[model samples]
Target: MQIPRWPIATEREKELIDEVLASPHWGGFHEIVARFEAQFAAAHGCRFGISAANGTLTLELALLAAGIGPGDEVIVPAISFISTATAVSRVGAIPVFVDIEPYTFNMNPSRVQEAVSAKTRAVMPVHFGGPLVDMDRIADVAARRGLIVIEDAAHAHGSQWQGRPAGSFGLLSSFSFQNGKVMTAGEGGIVLTNDEALAAKMRSIANQGRRPDATHFHHFTLGTNFRITALQAAVLVAQLERLPAQIETRTANACKLLRLLEGVDGIRWQQVHPKINRNSWYLMLGRVEGGAGRDEFCRRLREAGVPCSPYYPHTLYQNPLYRSSPCRVTPCPNAEATIADAFWIPHNVLLGAGGLMEEVAEAVRRAILRG
Candidate 1:
């Protein structure tokens, strides 16, 4: 089957790039950056947006803005991109690793409650692979424990839970515009918040602590430069225009593929809750069944022309860097089991025609049978 290419650049992208190239202000202060920030935030039902150089820096900035400093602890999922845990360390806070739901690949809310401690100040739940975490449960825990909620929405561009957008449920939410993300500008990120004061603080931190109206080289607080370029923002603006339609296409294709795989042995797809109104479908996650090794299954699927991968071979705590990092760990059986079985089909494949989904299902069956 022919799979569609990702980060599809059209005439609109070219037009936007040209505009940024011709403009005098190519820096972060450019109007184009502000426009992209506003537009992207509004799309996710956020009141304000602050653009940054990269996704990791955005999380650090959010931590800083929230006053999560040394000795503070932040609860995080055991299975996620390294940044989810490292971001807490970068801000001088320890990450408390919690188990995930085997099927959803998101942090188990019950585990979150167990991980909380006197030092716990916040919870950072990642909407892993475009499916929103259980925000309702996370919120209830946070409210009772007096902990803040910061969403790691890097994989959930247009996902929603119970009709609420992914970024809107948390006190602060971060999004990545990395090359592989559903939205891409090569490298960029943003933070969204409903609180005007928090938004100003984040902007200041990303702008080297300069006050919004400062005309001189004045620094109010300790901050660093995590600014995004006008060029990247221009590209993001163009990409944003394509997001809604792309999300719809991906979701439709995912549904078709899931239906085709129904009752099929040797495979189990992610179990999305009914409350999840829309899933971004960044990657269609599935687990190998019938005793096939995850890597072998992925190898055979690739040979059969299926764009698949065995993602996250191990939990984040197992990484060498985490060996010395100040993080609290607990046994996460679900996360460990998922690492042994998870496989992913990239979102670009879902951009293909509905018939291509049949080809994908067939490829899966072939890979399993061959194994």
Candidate 2:
């Protein structure tokens, strides 16, 4: 049997929704939403939470709240998902592309300092592939340089760095609740911040730039109608309850595969930085060693009753947008190198059984030896 990347919801998800349907609260502004916001904020150790339409809006609003808009340059890692750069561009800010570390897949913090200049307004470091960035180092640099730090935490839910939660490190953090994430709201996202004023600005900015019940129903700061349905919040609340168990299972499964794949030739393993305690193992990446290539490796794994890919073969900067952006993609040489090298595999707990991950790892070991 093929191992699915994300299985259908367990019974708990349905039961939670049934309870929501039976209740009076449904919209995001309702009491249940507040409950979720409070619980999430408490979990992340943040002072305020503003749930938005999705991860894209989460960062977009965050940019606006952090006072980033036209002509300002927001430094972004080229290896991350496009939304990272788009969020900056959405607010009319120019995205200054930066490189990423080959092993950690997080932004190269040292290089980030070099990228900053007079036009630089904010540094948005993405915790790519569920690895935590060295936030303290990044923050110190931001402080000295007079820049805001925003975290694209789409992959790092429940991840920790030196006893601090991933979302708590940056000036503001963006989270995704799309179907594939650790916690899925079907379609949800949020921006968490310790800064109360910034949080308030994000809230109003995300909701069409109007204060709730303001005398001027007028849309004030050139905003979009980015609001998640109450149903999304209700569904997310259910997922949030199961998150601890899910993360535990995912982490364990990732460790199991990591150990199993170790000492195997041709499987380039991703290394976590020492400071990261709880890694949100969203996807496990493997590079074909020696003569074996990513395409062939993924193909063999798929044939072995495992849905191995949906590969992110290269960095997002190699994409045409950045290639043609007049700024040039070659500037971030390391980011381009890291992105061109690997393919992603299913990190699903279920994939461990059915000899899936083991089989895939074994196949790569064999292919590299034979080829």
Candidate 3:
């Protein structure tokens, strides 16, 4: 059972790249980059999109655009990639870490209320592994608390909740085109928003703080270069075209695998929310009974030719960098439990044929049996 290679490039990608290489403007000011930005934003149901250097910088740009600076705080999940919290810190604000849901491994909205402080300016919910955070609950909390919602939608390109797209739910949502993400451009990111003023601000900030129409070398605000080049955009445009089909395939394979694992003991799959109409299926997540058994289980699965690994072994607060950082931390039993038990199968494996999913399920069953 051979798995498909990731970041799959076809003739369309080559054609776009050739166009960019032949064009005079291969920089951020090219039409190719602008086109990709528009296409991605439209697909996610957003009014404006601003391209950036990478996902991390896009989060920082969103924070800065929202006026989140010193003396402010942002609520984030304890179980996300470090960038979710670090982006808040990069903008001179503190990140208040909250717990996540044990089953979904997403920010626990019930914990958001307790994490809110007088200094809290926004709530940045990450859609971990392509399953959306409970946006409806997160929105209600933010509204009552008067906090902005900035979605770290790095793992949620096509994910939707209650028929609404992931990038459209927040004041500003960020997406990554990193190599590991469902969509890839080698390295790139984009910010999506409906607010025209906020869009302009992020656009300017990403392009060295100059007005979009400015012809001269005049800096309007304190900003640095965090621009995406035409080359990356060219690849991303082709990738975006291929995304819908890929998402369908991944979802089908995920459903098949889940069905096959139904009677398997000691394994619990990530529970999808009732409201989630679509999941991007970036990774198929699950957990075993014991933390001690998790590693050996993964080792066994890999030996059986199923690509698997433990998901974030530690919560963000457990990192050494957080110890000296100016951030607030609350008890996160769910996050801790998730770190101990959860493992993941990469999205690329799901891109394989339906028969491959059967092999994956058999591998899981064997791993559990041996343990």
Instruction: Assess each prediction's global lDDT (C-alpha) against the native.
Output: 0.91, 0.75, 0.91
- Name the lDDT value of residue 202 in candidate 3: 86
Candidate 1 structure lDDT? 0.91
**Taking the tens digit of each residue's C-alpha lDDT, what string does model 1 give over 185-270?**
99999999999999999988888889978864999978789999999998999999999999999998998888888888878889
Model 3: CA > 4 A from native: none
Candidate 3 TM-score over all chains jointly: 0.98
C-alpha lDDT (0 to 100) for residue 313 of candidate 3: 66
The TM-score ranking, best first, is 3, 1, 2
Q: Candidate 1: which stretches are off by over 4 Å?
A: none
Residue-level lDDT for 337 in candidate 3: 89
Predicted structure 2: lDDT: 0.75
Candidate 2 clash figure, as a count:
3
Higher-ranked by TM-score: 1 or 2: 1
**Tens digit of lDDT per residue, candidate 3, span 296-346?**
898999999888989986999899999998899989999988888899989
Backbone collisions counted per model: 0, 3, 0
